[model samples]
Target: MPARVFVALMVTDSGALTAAELAQTLRVSPAAVSGAVRYLTRLHLVIREREPGSRRDIFRVRDEAWQDALANRDALLAQYSGSFAEGVSVVGRETPAGRRLTEAMEFFEFLRKELDGLMDRWRAHRDAPRPDGPPA
Candidate 1:
């Protein structure tokens, strides 16, 4: 359902949809759409906002949604790395559990470090001049 909502929003010209509209488009109940939107919102794949001067909420998928989601993951990676580091410290690095935790910590730390460069490269590719015109 989240996938459906995401695709629906992506293909939508307005890049935004109300819960009732999503339900109608997807042929699902309002409750289903609500659940899906909640999940997507938590994942940073979609944003929810109240319809101005109305009670209905609108969900929008911005041009930078994907980029923002990926960038937000850097903080999660750091958090996981810190957690594993703390676990290792508590268990003693020489213990089997500590060794596992240390490995996990290193992996997350590596990803956090690499994500910066990866995002930069992505921006460069995204911002590179188009064939028909110059860079935006």
Candidate 2:
């Protein structure tokens, strides 16, 4: 999969790779690589860049890929919670189905709030000095 290829590149010393290079490394077709890159690009997990003095389009994972991915879930959470709330209203608050929807909506709302706090804590931790030593 393209995600696996991206992870491979991340673990390797070479942090970026051309489509052909990625296909070769992953034993997949160039078209597969392209599709993967396109998906990742849309999700803001990967970026496309030109190799200086070359025409090759290199694909590399963004530095904040994880953070961006996690943050993007807020929109999905909000949509799910909204839909659940609507379901509860349609089913009537006293019904079992309505209670289930209410529980789900509450859970999602809690997660949405916690996600914001978690991201903030992560940023602080990321910026904090390392007592052990510099990062590898």
Please give, for residues 83-114, the per-residue lDDT of candidate 1 as tens digits: 99999989999999999999999999999889
TM-score of each: 0.88, 0.90
lDDT of 2: 0.88
Q: Residue-wise lDDT of candidate 2 within 1-99, one digit each (tens)?
A: 767767866876768889898988888998888898888888888899999999999888888899999999999999999999999989987899999
**lDDT top scorer:** 1
What are the lDDT scores of the predictions, listed in order? 0.92, 0.88
Q: Model 2 Cα displacement at 46 (Å)? A: 0.8
Clashes by residue pair, model 2: none
lDDT of 1 at 127: 90
